[model samples]
Target: MQPSLAELQRALAARILAEEGSDLDDWICVPSEADSAARVAVYVQGYPARIREALRETFPAVAQILGDGSFAAFADRYAKDVPADLQNLNLVGAALPAYLESDRVSGDLPFLPALAELEWAVDRCFHAELLPPFAASACSGWSLDEWARARVGFQPGLALVCAPWPLRELRETYRCERSEIDVDLVDRHDQVLVYRRGFDVVVESIEAAEAEAVASLQCGDALGEVAAKLAGSGAEPAAVAGYFGRWASLGLVVSCEACPLP
Candidate 1:
């Protein structure tokens, strides 16, 4: 009996993954002329090739860490282990670090995955749609009491990364074409604030306290609560207010909802 089209497709997908020339019984037999196995190989090979190319472009620092050959091999295996599901290929490497942790593939460059994560965040932030800027003056109509309980909305592409290395600096200094290198990806710690600043994505270092403040705000905390968190870390109230104001001016806060003024 002839196999159904769906069955053939399933078989082809499986065959593409299997080792070359291994006679797996369930595989759809390739016709002599078409050579289904070879055809499948073409897709399987291209899958990782495309992914590696995209990732190399996105995370040049990661490429530098792994070098050309090792990076390609790693990319190929990672693709086989983690299939792409998103329409936007930009998101393909989002979980790469998580995958690397369990597989122990990143042991040589222990911080590589975190760097990749940071790089991916920057790429995503750059591509996200910008929202209309929010001005602190917009809240001027509200009484002091009303402003206290307002819920703040962040811009579409804000991402915070906590890493054990200075990913922001490393990526900034990384030049894929450079013939010589100097940065060491060793035991250092870094946190990153990635946000869309106008037409560009800006990745900058942030203190732990600042990261916490952003985290609190992102979790829907009231401005007062976020301010309290920041203040406890010795951040002056005036400075904190100014920080949020600047953030607002940059379109970092998309909207603000106020509480009833007392």
Candidate 2:
């Protein structure tokens, strides 16, 4: 009996992704004169090649760091291990950072996963929806007590990434200057703020405290709780206030809502 369409599709997909144990001839048909295995191999080879190009587009800095040859190999391995589950090619590399962190590829380049994460964040920020900034006038009417209960909402594109390597600087160096990566620079921790302003995606280095505060806000914490937590963690009130002002000016905060009265 002939296999169903779904079964044939499943078998072809498995073969294309280089999964083991799929007999190509069992699912594919070719003329007696034509090579069935060779035809299947063509699709198998093209799958990773297309995915590699997409990954290269998404992670130009990482591609430059790893170079063409190495990046191609890495992309091939990643595609095989984690097949593209999304219909959109733009999101194909969504699992790449995790793949890099897995035992399959993490041994040689410990920093690659973090670097991939930064790149992915930048890509996401560029495509994320834009919303109007929270009206500054709304804050003027709030009493100190009312302000404490307010929760801040961020723009859709905002992403904070904390990594042991200086991912932001490395990304800039590779992207802007096309310079060689410095191995010594990966020794320290760094936090990056990624967001879109107008048509450009901006990547800025931020202090650890600021990253934490933004993370808290992103998690729906109220201003009062975030402030108290920051104070407990050794951040001065003035510093926190200043950071909030900066964030507001940058249009990172898109909405503010007061907590319900108890």
Candidate 3:
């Protein structure tokens, strides 16, 4: 009895990813002296190679840290563990940060997972849909009372990543020079804002207090509420005002709507 088309495809995929459990000699015919298995081996080898290339493109910093040989081995294992399910190849490494954090993939380096997270944010920010920045003139008509109740909506391209490592510096260093991978990993915590400015993706390191305020605003809190929270945390009223203005100037805030008064 012949195997179904779905069965054949499953077997082929299993063989390509795991390099096991499929004998193509029965179904495949080769005209040359080379056996049918040899022909299938070409595709089997190419499968992981393609996945590795995609991973390298997405996580270049991780690849640099791991080196070519180690990265290749890591990519092979990752490919086998998490096969690409989406039609788009760029989404292949979406789960890589989590995989790196797993105990299964142990490593001497502790910052690899955080670096992967930062790289993935860059990739995502680059491809995110562009929305026209909110016009500053829109705020001209709001009264002091109305402003208190306003809720600012962040841009779709905005991403806030709080990491235990100096991810922004690490990413920039690797990007500037792959050979210069020496970075001190102790006592460095970074709150990074990843967003697209026009055509470029910008990753900026922010102060912890500012990150807290931004996170509160992003969560749909009213402006007055955020200001109060910051004030309670020892931030002055003037400083809170400046922070909101800076975010607006940076094109981070998209929409500012006054919450309806009850």
Candidate 4:
């Protein structure tokens, strides 16, 4: 009449994740003086604590902006709302940015969602693999037509986050290692690029045209299509070329695929 090991595991999981009454108490043993409910409570409390700690580490700026008390409260609510990804605490904060978009905290600080997004991007880039520097000489023989027809690939660590807020300044102000300073939170379109350069992650503001071009490329658009879109947006003829030039110099570019003209 005893529950199987698999059944005990299922019940224990339900107990930890939520307030689901389970007969797991009947399975786990403890000191005669201690209770099974106390053992279950340890896991119930520890799991959320571990998740909050991971989120704080990954989103130090957000945590600083929210302050210790508010961040803790929001993290607990998030733990309840969003199921942990792959049961890994390290990946728990992956949903924080989207979760903040609708949370009450965002109502007070309108930039919270974008800021969290940038932080997440930073974390991802730091963890991404560093690819070998791409050789630009590979395209020396390509004509303009060939270049336009090509689909460009970028480094694995590249990520673009666009927001209508001065995101870079805000991120630096509360960044983990910095003194508090006044930062103007002017509402303006900010296109931020995050990529791993050498051994460190670089987070910098980029021009709108560049962000647009990179975004198109990230979407798998051909270089000519990206150029046409940029032209429609009033970007100069040389603007698309400039983007590629800069990207190549920075090692952001990885490869280019162009078919020979018939």
Candidate 5:
């Protein structure tokens, strides 16, 4: 009896990825004159090659830091350890940030996980669909009372990364084609906002107070509640307006809703 399509696919995957080339050939393509095992070897090499290319594309900064040979080694190890079940290569590096954190692949580079996280976020934001920008004029008619209870929504793929290292600077260090890297590994608290601007994904460092309000809004808190929290934290709650204005200008905001009454 012939193996089903699903069975053949599973066998092929195991043969290529796990090298579990047992009776896989028995269920594969109808025995042709050509060497079928050679065909399988093509996939065996191609799968890892494709995944490595995708990782390089998604994490160029990481590749630059790790160097070609080292990065390829790490990429291969990651691909092998973590199954790439998805057909889309773009999504393959989605878990790389977490993997870096869990694997602790580099002891010298303590910031690798955070850097990978920022790069992954940039990749995600670039691919994310941008919705219609929120209109600040929509709140023109609302009274102060109504404005306080308004719940804000940010654009899709907006990501916040707070780290003890200057992640943006580190990423920029490798962003350009430089022959040599003069890295200043300064340890300081850095908060950055990642979002799509037109077709480009941009990363900008933000203030601590602004970061607080953004974090609150991201948590689904009302603007009034965020303001109160900010005030309690000794931050100027009114500064939220400036932050909102900047976000609106950058097209980060997508929606705003008022608290519903029973």
Candidate 6:
């Protein structure tokens, strides 16, 4: 019997996938075929190559850590599993950690995944559109009660990443290295926040309390709750206040619903 439209489409899709050298299929077109397979291979393979190139450029430190061979192998598998779906290649490696954790590509490089996460987040922040400036004067209109109940929204580009390695410093230092770097002893775990301050990507090594506080605020927690959580951790209220001011100055605060008068 002849195949239906859906079946033919499916077979054609399979043929396309196979010609692209997909491991899912044995062979696509027979030798009698002209330059069809050859032509298709160019487009198919370019997808993975382009994705790998973008990731390498965005996360040089990760490439350095995994070495060229390992990096390429991992990137190839990542491409096969997660095809390039976004127009922005910067987000290409966002799921790398989850991919690494899977049994297929599991390795001893636990920290490599976290490093990649931080690197991609930083790159994303650098390219994100500028947000409206947070007015310090906005605080003046709110009373103490209203301020306490205010929920804060973070800037679009700010991302708080908890890394098991000194990803923040490692990335900055690697960018400045002359020849290359030998991955030496690395910190077990660290907390880093990547935010775009003005025109530059600013990476700050923040404490756990600060990370949690920022995360809570991002979740739309009321100002009083966020402050209470920070205070519970023995974080100085004055110091936290200063940090908040600096963050606002950097265009990190998207909007604060309510807050005490300045």
Using lDDT as the measure, the top candidate is 4
**Residue 181, model 3: Cα distance from true site in angstroms:** 1.9
lDDT of 6 by residue, 1-262 (tens): 6556676566555543433433323334546647766765675677668878987888787776666787788888777777557878767877876676672433676666677778878888888887897787878776767867877777778888886677665665455453466445365467898888777988888888778778888787776787888888887644556667778877787777764446
lDDT of 5 by residue, 44-110 (tens): 8898899999999999888888888888889988999988778899899988988888664668788
For candidate 3, write residues 36-152 as lDDT tens digits: 777788988998899899999999888887878888999988888886789888899999999998734346877788888889989998998877777889889889778888898
The residue-by-residue lDDT of candidate 2 on 197-216, one tens digit each, is 89799999988888888888
Q: After superposition, how far is residue 67 of candidate 6 from its true place, in Å?
A: 1.6
Q: Ranking under lDDT, best-scoring first?
A: 4, 5, 2, 3, 1, 6
Error of 5 at 23 (Å): 3.1
The residue-level lDDT of candidate 5 at 68 comes to 83
TM-score, candidate number 3: 0.90
Write down the TM-score of every candidate: 0.83, 0.89, 0.90, 0.90, 0.87, 0.77
Q: Candidate 5 overall Cα lDDT vs. reference?
A: 0.85
Model 4, range 145-217, lDDT digits (tens) per residue?
8988888888898999998888888787565543464557766779999997897999989999999999999
Error of 3 at 248 (Å): 1.8
Q: Per-prediction count of colliding residue pairs?
A: 0, 0, 0, 0, 0, 1
Runs with alpha carbons beyond 4 Å of true place in candidate 5: 1-8, 24-39, 176-179
Over 4 Å off in model 1, which ranges?
19-40, 176-179, 184-188, 260-262
